[model samples]
Target: MQTILSRVLKNSTFITSIISILLGILVGAIMMIMAGYDPILAYNALFASALLQPYDLGETIRTITPLILIGLAVALAFRTGLFNIGVEGQVIVGQLVAVIIGLKLGLPPVLHAVVAIIGGGLAGALWAAVPGLLKAIRGVHEVIVSIMMNFIALNLSNVLIRRWLAQGTDSTPEIPESASIQMDFLSQLFGGARVHVGIFIALVAAFIMYYLLWKTKLGYELRAVGYNPLASEYAGMSVKRNILLSMMISGSFAGIAGAAELLGTSGYQSIQATFTGIGFDGIAVALLGANTPIGVILASILFGVLTYGGGNMQFEAGVPFEVIRVVFAAIILFVAANISGPLVNLFSKRRRDKHRARHLD
Candidate 1:
């Protein structure tokens, strides 16, 4: 049992993630106490609200639908040694494109939905390609370009929506039923919650990403370039092409997240006063998950639970909902600290020294 425990603890990344979560919870409890709230009661309410009811569970799953895709997007980019700060822009562009296609295209129900979703993915890929191309060709920093593109995408989406699709209000017309991703059976199963078939789509996407990154030659090239661009280039790989490909792929995942939101839930694109923070939250998700596909899925679930349950905490315990965000922020900070490796190493060294002394005796 001791050997098994030590072996499990030796996984520094897992240990770090777990420790970060526990520490974040501790910090949250301390804050709750300082604020004159019972931390245990607040947390109990949160968990009860989120998991003890079918409706809230469905909503939690729905919320994580986009988060899963966005987390995967950021993780993919990180694995390729790129930071895709423009997932927000890509999502905006993709949502606009999806709405346009759903409104304009007339086809069979399944075909129409499929085409609109694909259009959204393509738009995101194209939008991200610009930054990738600039980074590859002109040596422009991707972070700067991506951030600027986010602003541009926001403005452009508003302009296009108003000019072409906006109804009496700031949002586009409701998408046709044919293009909707909602399934009546799924909703019924979840006690009439608005959760849709998009959750399954997200699962499939995660599997696809895992396969693409781990099983394919193209993925190998991309990973190689990410590991060492100079070495990859010396080995006759096209670093520029791989960079562009990585951004496009990453953008596609974010774009699909937008499509899922529109077709599965919102059914229309609204002009936003501010960028939706899903893309930004995705950064934390990726970090917490250690940039792996499976890790992203699990991290998305944790975020989903916290976000969906926060309202209940406020309602039932009078705790501020923003406390959830604070906990999430603390988790991100600890994960970024990367302190688990040294702790694990120290423990392993002590164990080795003790074993040596026993042998000498």
Candidate 2:
């Protein structure tokens, strides 16, 4: 068991994530003590609410579903050497398109849902394609273009929601039942929490991403370009084309996240005064997950637990929920500092030296 644990801890990414989380917890405890709160009681309430209660657990899962998708979006962009700060815009466009299609299309239940979801993803892909094209063709920095596009998408979504698609208010009408992703059995099983079949969708998406990134030729080209675009271009790869493709794929994940949130949970699309922080939060998710599909899923679940439980902590311990955000920020800071890299190297070197001594003996 010890050997197994040692092998697992030898993985740099895993070790880094664990260390970051531990440091985050320690810092959070210190902050709570400074704020005149009992850290142990606060954390107990948080865990009890988020994990031990059925309704809260379901809500945590609901939060995890979209986070998994958005995390994948950010991870994909990072792997392709692009900063996709426009996931918020992609999500907005996706939700708008899904709402429109769900309202207008009359079809069989399964077909309607599928079409609406796909349509939303396509809209997100198109929305992101603009920035991708500018970056690829005009040599404009993608980060700048994506940020500008975010504002455009937000304003456009607001206009469409209020004027064009609004039933009477700043939101579209509840989508047709056929287009919903709600699962009655799961809801009942979870004590009427809003958990839905979207969790399954998120899982499938993660599997697909894993397969695409590790098993496909196209993925190789994309990663190769990311590592060195000039070298890839010299090797006869289309660097520009790969950039566009990567952005579209990344945006599609964000679009699916929007679809899941609207069709699976909210049942209606509402205009937002500001961007939902999910897209931005996805950056942290991808960072902590080390840009891997499995890592993203695990990290998303952790985030979901923290987010859902933070409310309970606040209510029970009189601690501010913003402290959860502070914890998260601390974790990100530690990860960025590469605190675990040296530790990992030191352990590996010690292990190798021990093996060499054993062989000589």
Note the Cα lDDT for every prediction shown: 0.90, 0.90
lDDT of 2 by residue, 1-361 (tens): 5456556666658888889999998999999999899999999998889989888999999999989999999999999899999998998888888888899888789888889889888988998899899999998998999999899999998898899888788788999999988988999999999999889999999998889988999999989989999999999999999999999999999998888788889988887888888889999999999999999999999999999999889899888999999999999999888788777567778778888999999
Cα error of candidate 2 at position 289, Å: 0.4
In model 2, where do residues sit more than 4 Å from their true spots?
1-11, 345-361
Model 1 Cα shift for residue 2 (angstroms): 5.5
Worst 10 residues of 1 by lDDT: 3-12
lDDT of 1 by residue, 1-361 (tens): 6566567777647788988998998899999999999999999999889888888889889999999999998999999999999999998888989999899888789888888889989988999999999999998989999999999999999998888898767999999999998888888888888898778888988998899889999999989999999999999999999999999999999999898888889899988899989889999999999998889999999999999898889999999999999999999999999757677778788888999999999
Model 1: per-residue Cα lDDT at residue 93: 89
Top candidate by TM-score:
1
TM-score of each: 0.96, 0.93
Query: What would you estimate as the lDDT of candidate 2?
Result: 0.90
